[model samples]
Target: MIEIACDESGADGENLVGGNTLFFAHGSVDVSVEFAGSVISEIRERIRSPAEEYKANHLLREKHRAVLEWLLGALRGRAHVELVRKESFLVGRVVEVLGGEGAPSGEGVPEEVWGAFVRAGNRLLRVRAEVDSGVLVEEFFGSLDALRSAVAGTEAGEMLARLSGRRERAFAYRASIPTLIPVLDPLFPTIVDTAAHWSSPGTPVHLVHDRQTLLTPARVEWIRQRAEARGVTLAGLRLVQARSDPRVQLADFLAGIARKIAGDEATGVGDPVLGELLRPYLEAGALRGDGARKG
Candidate 1:
């Protein structure tokens, strides 16, 4: 049996950059159990602060980067991380630029152009703030119209049209899930599938997630049913406080790190240290969506 400890970060309204992490250990002879404790201790000592403090601050500091790097190195092959992030603001910007409610009006957009639009949108959002919602909305849409007209018949316009379809699908899926579990609804099944992929044939997996009020008994049952339908052998699923479990603490750290990295990426910032630590797993395609998960 394998024990998976899961946790998520970035649920606050401003930072939609969030994801879940799974810290895996074989039920028998798992070395991660001990390694987690040592890593936690080392992290605590390095930061001169409690684990909870690091989590609360979103672990974005250069000082904390090394500890996070160490943690990632330790869990390199043992954990699976998954992140689901949506830049609604950027989506909105794209909608504005293309003269549509969502997506561009033309054909298809190249990935590079889409990326540039997102980055430019991020910069714009960052620089202009503290404005009335009504005014902001008006300005945003107006800007979109201006951009659409200016770029009409240009390469950028064509690229925006191409990118619209994909963005529309993402927005559709984002709208379907309950707002409360926007991150978890899609995440739960993906994690279960990941566990099944890593487990021995016919082995039952037990899941333990950091306690959340939203993950009621009914929700757990729903996840179990879905996993069962998918032929994933789920022996049990329960919620526990991270304080009582070192593995859960590691999960929390992983989730927090993933969120910060995602937020940085959306804003066009880079953290070389964190990037290097994650390079191996990323190259192996271990991360799902914006989060990290075992492949």
Candidate 2:
């Protein structure tokens, strides 16, 4: 028998970080598990058609539909398909905290965070399911620890702690079963959000400082120029803004560096080439440089 575990992921922010993630797994000891490949193929076809822009949310559902349809069509004549997932109730606190008021939520958090959780939950389910299906799943077992790491949210940690003991039961399986399991990546929305948040104002300046300390010398010179151009006295503004718009920041930063280099050749820091490069960023209201643009 073969076992499968699945997971998925999506973007998280305007900067485009962790967004959507999903995961699940299945296993069976039937050495001649006949329908798995066909089921995966069918799922691939359905998802790819309609030429729709594929988002992270569609994958797991597609897998489910694929498995169910294939089972009913080809294998119903032989094996009784039995599949199981742990029915984890979002605890009252989890629902209250992670989920919002009234209709419920994990809404405020980035979708990728929830995606990681789903991946972890599904991976655990896969281990249990394999045992129930009497399958020896030797591959990818080490991945379970990674799943746990992904889903362990700092903000939601307490709520998750509450879920440890409640109704964490595994399902039983029977003979002649043909199952297809879809697995996906556990998302890292927190990583993206953390980046965005750290770049925002009123955040610790040291965060940016720490990042700046790690930049290459060329990038460092680039930042110095950009900051001088903007007359920005505040620490970390250049780096934070640059992280958001690398291209624009790089151009302006380079312009600033050029002006400085020219200063060594002449008297004061002024150069037509520098002005030309910085003008667009200034006009777009995206950057502020040291001196007003000169003709």
Candidate 3:
């Protein structure tokens, strides 16, 4: 049996956006070239559409299963794939473990808490992966670095940052590939005990700049209405709504709206009304700047 624990860290907010990170450690069993190839293939097929792809399962589930199955197709064997994801603080701690301290912490602590057992489980996987000295793990961390760089200024950064800081806000995992090992050993309790103490207090996702004021309510409303008609949610409409400027770049505005919407969903309020409410300053550049009537 191989245990894999994956984690992501980042922030999601209107301003002060950062990026998200995903880290997972797998048992020595699946740390093979064949398994890595299969997992990559499955993930590529899965992420074809961002709209459809969700972080519902652990990173090493079926996506990694394809490789194992392909390699052991002929023989009748059994292996249990246990996968878990811990984002935000737990992710931060794991990264601290991998890269050392001084990694940036995310904002907002999750309401829930992660005990030592879970931490131990996570670390055990990491230890196994490191001991194996698999080049794939090195590559995985490399890609994570690139992802962080790509979303530095945008909403992507916010979402990434949000996930990195919270302990309870992680995605789900599933042990998709099942194999029969005569004797599967449980991880030592001491490993879990060691990691149980990791914790980072919740911090607010505050904007670096002053909060933008709501200006042209009417024009913002009109654009929001149009955005809604085009299948954009009301909250999404608000992130880019600017009452005074009707000629704003639709693409940039939409991009901002999309990022806010992503975080909004994670925030648990998917209502369109919220977006409509913020329409007045969507294009004003500064929320508190003068409206069309002012200048």
User: CA lDDT of 253 in candidate 2?
Assistant: 23
> What TM-score does model 1 achieve against the real structure?
0.58
Judging by TM-score, tell me the better candidate of 1 and 2: 1
Roughly what TM-score does model 2 have, to 2 decimal places? 0.17
lDDT per residue as tens, model 1, 1-295:
7767766665432222222222221111123667778876777787786335446253457666656666677777776555544444335444443345433422254444444444444433332346543444444434444455556787655654454444434334323424433332334444555456456667777877778776777767766776777777778877788787777777777766665665565455746566566554332432223223321
lDDT of 2 by residue, 1-295 (tens): 1111111112111111122211111111111223444443454576664632322234324354443333334432222111111111211212232222221124454565544444434433331343533232111122322333444665444444443333212112123221221111111211122223223344322112112332445544444444334432223322333223222222222222322322322334444443343233222221222121110
lDDT (Cα, tens digit) per residue for candidate 3, span 212-256? 232135533543454344433333112223222221211122223
Q: Which stretches of candidate 1 lie over 4 Å from their true place?
A: 12-32, 50-59, 88-187, 193-197, 281-295
Order by TM-score, highest first:
1, 3, 2
lDDT of 2: 0.28
Number of the top candidate by lDDT?
Answer: 1
Better of 1 and 3 by TM-score: 1
lDDT of 3 at 14: 12
Kindly give the stretch of ten consecutive residues in candidate 1 with the minimal lDDT sum.
21-30
**Alpha-carbon TM-score of each model against the true structure:** 0.58, 0.17, 0.19
